[model samples]
Target: MNIRFDGKRALVTGAGKGIGRDVVKKLVECGAETIALSRTQSDLDSLKQECPSIIPVLCDLADSESISTALKDCGPIDLLVNNAAIAICESFFDANTADFDKTFDINVKATIVVSQIVAKGMIERKAGGSIVNVSSQASLRGLKNHLIYAASKAAVDSVTRTMSLELGPHNIRTNAVNPTVTNTAMAKVGWSDPVKVKAMTSLIPLGRFAEVSEVVSVILFLLSDFSSMVSGSCVPIDGGCVAS
Candidate 1:
């Protein structure tokens, strides 16, 4: 069970906190040289304080220019984890147009652009690396008040499948991790209602939320050689929520 990514180079988006931060730390711990990208300098600074070996890059997924600049400095990446995303817990009728645009920009568009740039480098080098897009169970089923967010993630799932097919010939494998109701600060924002939380948890056969480490373990497996033949599929780490 000792999966090691020793000597790999990884770039993780939204590594300022939550799942992204944990993923960067986990990758580094597994022996991959990691570059953490986020819009907040302080968060990146904090990560550096904790792990000085991690290289921090400031990049806003919403800004094309910033993303391009950050990629330029990234040089080449052996593994790309598109983990940045945004959401708003409001009915479709109450959702703001601006928020809708912003949500798609970060959740879908940014993931695509960044992956293309990095995957190109991987292809040219013939490195045949792996891409783990942080998708969600939202893409699998509809959720109340998650109109825009669900749409955005649905696109990610679709893109993952397409990328897998397009990149398969080049030896690049693209897949996604679809997690359900993980106990992250971000997840709490959507599950604040007591009734909603209980209802969602009840649907899960495991009857609980996943720890951040659980999700990180799945990502690590996908990045490592253990999943060398797995691609273009959505692996649900949903506590069996999808089964019920």
Candidate 2:
């Protein structure tokens, strides 16, 4: 299928690196007027330089005020990907309120904040849109040091469902993409040890983690008209890790 977004506008958070960075590039290639949001100016500058026409917004997703102010003039986004997230690896016993608050603020709360800001315009224009929340496979099942991270993602899934239900009437769709340890900077942080990586990979039927393109493909599909009927779903691009 020739998926295109010639005249549409898309906004992606965490566009500084990894999966989020790749998703923005793909959107630009697909003909969308894309906006890349990142807390780091260098990441946005390089992305804009690479994509030329891409708009770059600088905002730290952890701050609700920053998110709101940065995106207030986004102007009727047709697609949004709440891909900004951070993971503080603390075992259940070791986790604290500080880490918990930080995780939820970005992974769960920022997703809601950005979606709400963008969705209001969609509702006003009566134009509808799509939102993809970048959750994690850790959300499905517990992990050793993923206590707070897992909880935040579980909340993201809940957000996806509720938004889909409420926004469906307005022709808006919301979904979550849960990916296993992809070869990204974040993966390096959590899956750095060879022993841990080996142990983790062994559980997946594919015997491997995912690539950025693999996850980006699914995100773009959901953002496009191709996934018109697929909403309120937690789709896993985990190489069957979740299934296995």
Candidate 3:
């Protein structure tokens, strides 16, 4: 299918690296005017070099005020991707309140904040829009040492559902993409151990983790008009891990 976003404007959080970066690139390639948001200015600079037309908004998701300020002049966006997240991986028994707070601050709270801001604009315009929340397979199934991370994503999925229910009347669709261990820099480090990789892949029927493009493809679908009827759904790009 040939999906194009010729005149659409998109805002992607955490667009400096990993899945977020790939999503930005894909949107640009598909003819969308994209806004890239990241906390790291250097990373955004590098991304600007790669995609010169992308608008960079440097906002730390942990701070509510910063989010407000960064988006003050962002204009109206047709698509919103809440992809910024931080995982403080620790066993449930070993996790601390600080880590839990930080994890939820970015993963859950910021997502709601950004979506609300963008959705309000869409509503006012009476044009409607799409929102894709980047969640994880951990939200669906328990994983070792991912207690807080899993909880945050679970909350994201909940927000996606509620947002879909409330916003559907206005024709704004909301959905979540839950990916497995994607082959990004962070995942490379977290799943670097040979034994751990083997054990994890063994559970997935496809016998491997996801590629950055694979996840990006799903996100693009959710944001595009092709999915006009799909909302409040958590689509898993887990290679059958969640199925098993």
Q: Tens digit of lDDT per residue, candidate 1, span 98-132?
A: 88899999999999999999999998999899999
What lDDT score belongs to each candidate, Candidate 1 first? 0.91, 0.92, 0.94
Give one digit per residue, the lDDT tens place, for model 2 in 31-104.
99998999999998888888998889999988898887898777779999999999888888999998989889
TM-score of 2: 0.98
Per-candidate Cα RMSD to the true structure, in Å, reads 0.9, 0.8, 0.7
Clashing pairs in 1: none
Q: Candidate 3: lDDT over CA atoms?
A: 0.94
Record all residue pairs in model 3 with backbone atoms less than 3 Å apart, i.e. clashing.
none
TM-scores for every candidate against the unseen true structure? 0.98, 0.98, 0.98
Stretches of candidate 3 above 4 Å error? none
What residue runs in model 2 are displaced by over 4 Å at the alpha carbon? none
Count backbone overlaps in model 2: 0
